[model samples]
Target: MAGDGTIEKVSIIISKGSLEGVYPGLIMANGARAEGIEANLFFTFFGLDAIHERRWERVRLATVGNPGLHLPTWVGALPGVSALMTRYMARRMDRLDIPPVPEFVEMIADTGAGLYACQASVDLFGYRREDFIGQVKDIITVGEFYDLAAGGQIIFT
Candidate 1:
């Protein structure tokens, strides 16, 4: 374990599986690697979408059911509202100079953070190997992920 109780290796589990949740995991993993901590990120459930090659390009904000959205959760839940909200958020992010999700993923990958897509989730979602983005190291089972996460600082972000 590390002096601060952070282990020499850190495993991050990104389960939220949305555009909003994706950045924190990527950013944190990269930051951990920058600090000389070995880092790995497992993308499961909705997060698997972030690593999907076909769908990644279409990644959008989750307006509906997202309590953190600028609009009221009810408004976001309304049909067509989510799309508009997603577009609005994208525009706002652009104005704020925030990079897109794919760009952020690229940046994280550049830092040598290990990226994995959950094999079980992928199969459940009917995603083939070719559907995932290029940065994924491999498709791993939850048990395999646990093996890596064990004895390390495991964080679910």
Candidate 2:
């Protein structure tokens, strides 16, 4: 679509904290960047965890409520299911050569994509700007994000 010269940029909003939740946004941002499209990743609410240094390495798949998994919500609540699912995912990604979360963030940042933390979510959760990963360009408000993303497609994941 970008070759048409109409869609030159993209803004992605990531609102979930799980491993699966975080990947789609990063993957899309990376894909856009690879396509020579400018991309901005807006991390809000639980999504902020994806860019937090201490938690990024620990982020795991959220299995409990995922209807797509076919396992009932309570089934995913079994003691080790989440961990198992996360490991399986990690292995699957390894086979596909997908970098781990932190590395993936760094890779995207290295590609010139903008990484941002949502100010309201940061304030609501009592997180200081310094708590974010170095790749984050800045912590921004939703209005600021809108201004930055003007004329671009917006994708929420």
**CA lDDT, every model vs. true structure:** 0.81, 0.93
**RMSD after Cα superposition, model 2:** 1.5
Candidate 1: C-alpha RMSD to true structure equals: 2.2
> How do the predictions measure up, each by TM-score?
0.85, 0.95
Best candidate according to TM-score: 2
The runs of at least 3 residues in candidate 1 whose Cα sits more than 4 Å from the true structure, single-residue gaps closed, are 3-7, 92-97
Q: What residue pairs are clashing in model 1?
A: 17-46, 17-47
True-structure lDDT of candidate 2? 0.93
Report the C-alpha lDDT of model 1 over 39-144, residue by residue, as the tens digit. Answer: 9899998888778887776677777767676567778778887677668777888897767788877777788888899988988988888888889999999999
Q: Candidate 1, which ten residues in sequence have the lowest lDDT sum?
A: 64-73
lDDT of 2 by residue, 29-145 (tens): 999999889999999999999999789898899889998778999989999999999999999999999999999999999999999999999999999978989999999999999
